[model samples]
Target chain A: MPISPPFRMEAMNNQSSEIIYTYAGPRTASDTGPFVKTRLMIREFIDARELIIRLFIRNFSSKYRQSVLGIVWAFIIPIITVGMFMVMGNAGVINVQGLKAPYAVYAIIGTTFFNLFTAGLTACTGSIVQAGSMIVKINFPRIALVFSSSLMGIVDTAVRLILIAAAFIVYRTAPHPVGVLIGFLSLIPLFILTLGLGLFFSLVAAILRDLINIIPFATMGLMLLTPVLYPIDNSSALGVVTQYNPLHYLINFPRDMVLYGSSELTTGYIVSAIISCIVLIAGWQFFYMAQTKIAERV
Target chain B: MADSVITVDGVSKKFSKSVRHMMLYGTLDLTAGSFGIPLARNRLRRGEFWALRDINFEIKRGEAVGLIGANGAGKSTMLKLLNGIYMPDLGKISIRGRIGALIEVGAGFHPMLSGRENIYINGSILGMKTAEITRQLDSIIDFAGIEEFIDSPVRHYSSGMYVRLGFAIIAHCRPEILLIDEVLAVGDARFRRKCLDHLKQLKENGVTFVIVSHNMQTIDGIATKGIFFDHGSLRYCGTPGEAISHYEMKMLGNDAPFPETLIEGSTKPGSLRLVKYFKDYGTHDIRFEDVRITNAQGEPSESFASFDAATLKVTVASPSETKTRMYCSFINEDMTVCMGAYMDISLKTGIQTIKIKFDPIQLTTGRYMVSLRLYDEYLTNPYANGHFGYFSVMKGGCVETPGTNTPYCWRTPEVTIA
Candidate 1:
């Protein structure tokens, strides 16, 4: 096995022979067709693994080192949001219903899962714009930036998962053993959907500065629409809109598995998993094609 | 063709003049590109102009190619294209080796991170592996000359320290092809010399170089070949000397020939003759008609005895009234300027002669060249400059030091007892 440098994927030839990179007339890697380009992109990603790890370390360390609260900010944010919603429930501002488990356990699990999508989406969307200087100066694989930022999101979510674990212990709520495993497996689709949309929005957000400002609000509104804080009201008109929301099934399936050990939403989960895969494939293709123009605009 | 590491063939690039059109067209093009819709790339749309129009060049392996042009002459665009930061619109560019660009070093440095930690991050961004960075860690720190502050956060580092560390990391990457912009003039003068020496060593070790600089002396020192760009078109590509002269002529907008051919009859009784090789640049408000060195006997001569008095007479032709200063510098064969003299002159619209006398010209025995530069009264803008000729100084003065002379006397020592 050859130990090539991590920034560039070598061509088929060895080091002695030259590797020719020809760029012409607004063309890019996708001109080779989607399948071949995707294969090449995978190889480039593999070659850029070390760079991804380094960038992740850089972002992860710099982000918390400057803050007074440090890593606690990750858990504190969702904890506060959960506290506010509980206060509203106590005040009778909103009705909390349809829970076999305690409302604290239910809401904490839901917020943790929901945060995986929202934070991941936000991080991925801003990755390219935040790395604007590096993008213009260097010729490294751009997908590495997204991957590193996505790792940050995953780490953030992992921190929040600790809060969920603490909530379970504090409430003495016993989750179904088999359901725990199934609930963890269900997070795969949610993560895939977040990364997929992140790939799309990151590129678009880099071009349009307005999307950078619009995304947090959009995801906040999405959280309300997806029933992340409360049980879905099936009889309400707003609940009808939730029927088409894929995040509803992706987030709810995991929570239902831990609470009920099985869910009637399995069919909906399967459909949403397929949708997530589709978004991922399409978003990857779009990101790959448009990345070559990024330096010029940024 | 196999030996050519970089080949840019008929490449052209365009940019939008207005920010609104740039965003609009960028979005439209991006959308069209994402949808796989082929648009007319060769044609320019509204509010767009060609930044580079049909440029063609090839750089062979182990060659140092210097790129020279005025600001916004597409030199930077060409460098960006070569580095794969931008794709061409009308032609193709092919490059064959791992490239290390010193275009803007320290661009990726995180201010909050320690210098030692940022080195690993910047090294990886430049394509060095972690193991490689670890191996070169001590050397990088040594090269940056900041061992004491390596662990300090770069936010506290001086700007000079920041660039030094950045350059140190990239320099150790051992790239096959190196691209340098106007970044070599960083840090202090000693550090700048160190960088140039290192670059020279790299060149000897067969690292191909593409340097873009406005400093002609630097380009002439390093570049085996020079490419001059004017108005987005390649105006000349040849030897470094010829390319620089051509570029300088264009910059001054002068039509006069550089290094005028030899002539016989111009030498008069009391005026010195000029050598065949001479370079001159000016606005033609005033021109050097004749330049000569006269010995103590008051006759033009090329060879002077050491410790003898000499007069440098410069005759100028001016078409209008102007006040300018003449600066004449004596340079040895090593091209080191030994001594210089200046005269402030106000000339009317005619030919006139100005003579500067040097009493006891004490330059040691050697051959030396005379360069005359005419500047405005404040000595800021250069109006004309020329190396008129060279003169020889023969052995006559007391044998003393090897460098230029300063007036001195030795007092007779009196015997004393303490």
Candidate 2:
């Protein structure tokens, strides 16, 4: 191995280099600069990758082990949700205009993609609280819990994509091949934004239990405001609300890409992506700072 | 300085008095922290109090330190802080090398998962790599002795099986520093013995340990050093023997040093008490001042080898010339009187001393209590009686007996061919 600095730490063989952890009174900044602290956090997270995978497998298998439906629940919920919206649209209880795709295809795509954000955020938010005893008794990267739960959400969303594919087969509709690829790419920003909010909400929800009960309702409300079930009429009041909602651009960009081959809201999508990145970075820093006391409070 | 593996400076930690306050303050802190405003951590806010206050200690590499304290005396808090679960509100703690804490075994086990799978999860949570766990899988299963049930769901396993599997995984993790809290006696006595033997082997291999236990025997048997915490303060830290004594003294209301006497019950002048002494009842007229047990070499000691000569010395202070019956009995730890002796003794106005010697004290390996009594001329209505002290007989004997080692010989027998 090449020689390195005196302060650098090697995991198992640190005979030559020293690693010291000094915990003192609360301070606004770590003894090391933010840049070094961020590096160390990232390194610690990387070192715990195995634990994250194991946790993910543990939760995934246990969640379905006792149920007869098992993995089918992943697609069942989305299908039932889309079926409800299609029924309402047929009855004219919900009206749509200027939509290129069939109502079934449009509703399926919207519900499944929006479900990614809602389900991912809800799972991530509950991860820390669900592992309360483990957090108090063991010392590991707390972010591993959030990451593993988010992985579960991702895998669950992947399963729902099979449902979306079956919907297109039934409707005899073909999505633009390039737009579909870009649409999958667009889910990255949405995932990042969900993770950022999940990190922040998980931290706060552990301290205030009301947030745990409040998140599902809040996500449902957000879905209505974001036009996930219907097309946005620019003159309607809900359309005005969608204009200010970041999720509006995040969800519509990918759905529009898969449907209409391209989106005219590129500027709004870029701005929302930037906002997602910022939220992720800020949420990560806050989680890192607040994790020290989580064991005690929990 | 580099050899010191763990250093806890003047560290302190605080907790809120109420859950409502905790939620409110947590929300406030998060909100304020987003604005880059730090909380007043050095001082206490409303509904906050220190759990551990300004504690300091250092453990050199390979030193096993035992923490002894009463319930709620901050021993667990100190362990949590050492494990980096909680940050200090004041001062600092610096530690080198990896730490593995056995605060609660099977902490992350999923009920629906099999033991084989939960081992990976639990091991990874303990900072072990997947390859390391795979390498140690068979050994972990063998050590836990649950191979037949390894593939079964953990929820179906008994609590003992669960703990054994958990401990087996952590024991193989090979942490540089191990911190344990009252989890030593996890399963049956046999399993406890196995765990203790494993800990001893680890200590021999230079694994640093910090253990918190209320079982003094466990601490004395394993730890090189002992720390005593009382009411959130470090009362003493020294060799395990001395720290145990200090802790015992404190726990017994600080009335246990040698030569310190306590008088129990009312010693009326002419009451013909027809019953035994309740707890060291004594009349001040004729009393035993000092009592001690000495070894064969005539040096005061509380422990002696079996078949070794021992001495018992008693100092008496009398008001006037009086005659009393001196009675002494050797009682085993189970309160059974193994031997007794009595003699008529004369005492002067001032102080008098008596010495009794036993050649080859025929006691087996165990602790024994000494009871001394001074009865009046009638050999009843005792002037004073006290359970003065205790001593122990260690190894070095031909045979082990319940009460005493009796001198005997065995005849050799010749076997005939069948």
Candidate 3:
């Protein structure tokens, strides 16, 4: 049989305009350069949000399915870890300066918050490798996978915070309203920082399988460097380290707000939020740049 | 004309096996080598290999194309690039419409989720909006034919049912461009046929398709054009028939010769006569008897059609007393058995003759194989036997291809009528 004639050929004359307008559904281009490019980026952001929500819900539901105590595992791990640390503190195995509160309460709050940060980071970092098959088969924003895993950590954190509130009520200790508000506000910056780190880690893990083994050790070290178990006072070497740690402000902001009724916003919190924003933006840019290589690598 | 839907321009994707295995830390260590001067020195040691080199093609709207290749031939890599699952290392791919892919169908399906819930989840993963899936839900369930079990967890589904549901959802996607990779061969015959028919219907509705398959017959039935890949490069791209013939030529070079006889005849009552037969008397090829049939009045006939009344007669010479059964059968060219007749009788010493007349031969219009079997029928069991005698029936002649339709032409003002 004779082969059919070749299909119509159309040369792309205005390539830049096509790329910008096509992303936003055939928009009329009135300006050139960065302004038009930003419009295309905004469209990509909207598309990414839609994909993230679905993946987040799917990942969250599948993890807890068929368990008798469905989402309670999220709360149970933090409670148990904090309880073990509280026992060490009460037995005079560790020392805390400048605090009269029960050692169990203080340890639970610190460990619970720090665990949320590290667990969220590790899970998010491994998301790309875990969903390797999906990455190779489906077409979507690759960063959605990393972000969804980080968001699932937020769900776990919400559960742990509820347990902390219950402990405070049981002990007949009232948390100041300002402290509770600060605790809630601190989560936003923590999530942003974790997401950025997760995307960077996920891309690295997808390309180099060895990163899967290394992430746990890195997160453990980060936890130790932060004051999750001990109190941070104004006049000590460990306190200076805690004050300097980027994640330290995130953990401490919530504890300071809920445990002490102080509403003073520190320069540390301001610096941490700025660092979180920079990381989140840079992390997204690096992930998108590396994602094209992931389909081949994975 | 400027109406092309896809344009792939000088695209090349190179993949190195060793570089893929290299750790991320290795790249960092190499780059971190004493800042500027050492970085230039370390770069000279890296290696590069190419998988796809300078490939180019264009697909217009409403075209159905097939991608054919051997196991490692970069056909899958090409599909991944088109779907935006992978980017080309060099050059560009531009596609102008909504694209849906069935590359590893059910890739994101969760076993714990019910079929209904998974439909939404899997649909979103394939780039469908929730509202779009809701609109297509009824059609998907109808096509899958799993409405009764839609609420059941997918873990309970058989592998076939899982694939059926996956294909059905993809079919309902209403994409402007669809990419399918060997997914049609996953289900049972009925579902496979259904998927092919649905794909054909979609092609007619102006949806462009790119199908990848090793099955030549399936590709021939659907693809208007085909591209063959050999060792990560385009070896041939043209008409489907030419592409399939090219693939078959390569496959035949690797296969052994066809067997002389696939089946041995049964031994029973009212069977064909055997003059001589041997199963292992030849080297590389088996040898058989010069078998023929005669009328009851003892006359020879060269041919017997199913419409003719005939008698079966046999004459055989044995070295000693033998107890065996005789068998006769008819089979089609494709090796489908049509009908059979057999007889068992006792023979004693040398030159034994057997004759049996059948009322009529019942068969369809096709070529068939006639086989006879002889086996020992005594000593322990009276029904055990050996086999012999094989021939063919060229009944009702061969089938012819259907005639093609001639295009009608009319006189135009641009052309002068003679």
Candidate 4:
């Protein structure tokens, strides 16, 4: 098996080559052509695996170059958000209710899980445009940017998990090991949803460029609407919106599965999982349609 | 043909001049394309024009081909297409082997990363394995001559250091094919000569190249074949010597902007083809007509000896009264301005003759073009300009100059007994 790099596909001799024969304008088969053939895309992913990991490390390492706190900066956001909510609950500004664990622990875990989605979506969506200099001059598998940028979420999640572990130790409460395992598994749906939306928006952002401004703004908005800061079982019109929101299920389902062993959120989680899968598949198709022309635009 | 690595067939790429319009039209094009209803293939939408059209060629493995053309002739676009930076709208370009392209300066290095770290990042982007970069890391640092500062962020490095590091990383990639755009001036004269020598050495090692440059002499030395493009169309394909001559002739001609159709593929070696493009002076402004160069005897000549006096007789005609300052610039073949003289002369409404003389033609054995640029009194906005003609200093006893080919003798100062 030859481990070719990205852009190396099956040649004419190997899988009939992308171009089995030469072509001029309007080759007879162009209209019927797959926007991006699945086999070719899969091969590209395989070839680009090394590049993806390298880029991920580059992004992760360069991200905190001059910061004084460095990787510790990852813990500050969740801790700050949890602290603010705890203070609000004490002041009687809003009732903190329905979290099965201690409120501080509940908010910390929720922020940890929610960060996965926000970080991944932001990374994936902005990767191509941020690396616009490399994109325009060199030709490599562009999808590498999508995967590599999204990988930053996994890195951030891992870093923040240490903070969560520290939180559990301080609280002197342990969740069911099997339920925690289920929580870990939920990362699949969460990652898929983030990656899918990212791939789709990358092309859109490349065109409008200003569209990326909305991604972070929108993610911040989604945080408040979802169960990141508060409990999910609300009794107002907010409950109606939260009930239908897929992100609501994604944020709380696994956290609930681990902290309480079970919650009335199984169906919502499954539905969110299915929707994420569809989004991932469809998003890749859309990314493929735009990927070839993206260099010109960027 | 069997060993060919690049095949570009009937490729045409169009670009919109306006960015907002490009975004809009690109959306419309993609939306229409999704319906399997092909959009208009042969029409230019608003603000849209063809950057390249009907470009066709092939590059066999191990062949170093040079691309020569004037600015905006689509040489850069052709290289970009081959590098897969731009997709062809009308045809297919199949390229084999791992490729490296050095398009612009700074080689896209991340500002926040150290030179050492950016080497790995840029190398990975260029498709090199981490293992490969590790293996070549010492050599790259050594070649760039920045080992001491390699650990510091490249953002703080001098502009020359940045270019050196950028070039060094790409040079170490060991790609099978290299596509270089015209940003080759990375450092001082000595560094440029070293880079040129390195490029020649790379060619000897069986790496293929399709480089675009305005330096005909560099192309002549490095390329086995040359492709000449004029206004997005391939005008000629042949030996580097002939294509360079063809390009020079077109520069001097007075024909239609660029002939729609071109005589494609090789002409005889060192042969010249003149393509005259004359822009109408139109209802206003000045006319630079009839330029004559004379050697020592005052007879018209195109070749001169070193340190020989020469005079340029320019006949300028203006329809309306205009006070024009005449500037005679000596330009090298690569179009680098060497030395120039300014004359604060006023032109009458009709034809007036002006003579500017070079006391000693202080130049070496090389080709040089005398550009007769007519400027307004402030010497800012050029009203009319063209190359008067070219002259050659055939032989010389002088030592080679440092920064240019224009000859000057070496001077040795007397050493005191201090």
Report the number of clashing residue pairs per model. Answer: 0, 0, 11, 9
lDDT of candidate 4 over A2-36, digit per residue (tens):
11231223221232122312211111123245643
- The local distance difference test score of model 2 is 0.78
Please identify which of the two predictions, 1 or 2, would achieve the higher lDDT against the true structure.
Answer: 1
Indicate the DockQ of the complex predicted as candidate 1.
Answer: 0.36
* Tens digits of lDDT, candidate 4, B295-404: 77878787676677877777678787777776677666556776677777777788876777776776654566666667788866567766533466553324333335
Sort the predicted structures by DockQ, highest score first: 1, 2, 3, 4
Worst 10 residues of 1 chain B by lDDT: B409-418
Query: lDDT scores for all predictions?
Result: 0.79, 0.78, 0.66, 0.75
CA shift at A142, candidate 1, in angstroms? Answer: 0.8
Task: Compose the digit string of candidate 3's lDDT tens values, residues A141-213.
Answer: 7767887888887787777777777778777777777777767777688888888888778887776778889
Stretches off by above 4 angstroms in model 2 are A1-34, B254-418
TM-score of 4: 0.77
Which regions in candidate 3 have their CA more than 4 angstroms from the true location? A1-32, A35-41, A233-236, A263-265, B18-49, B254-418
Please give, for residues B1-418, the per-residue lDDT of candidate 3 as tens digits: 1555667777776655575434543345323421322332212234545567777777777888888877778888888888887666566777766678889988888888889988888887776789978877887888888999998989999888899999987776667778999988788888887887677777766778898997665676778888888776787888876775565455433342323452444344334333233535222111122344544344555345444444444455555665565555555545555556555566655554555554444443333344445555542322222232333332321112111111122121111111
Ranking by TM-score: 2, 1, 4, 3
| Candidate 2: Cα lDDT at B227 | 94
Q: Could you arrange the candidates by lDDT from highest to lowest?
A: 1, 2, 4, 3
Index of the highest-DockQ prediction: 1
Model 3 TM-score on a 0 to 1 scale:
0.74
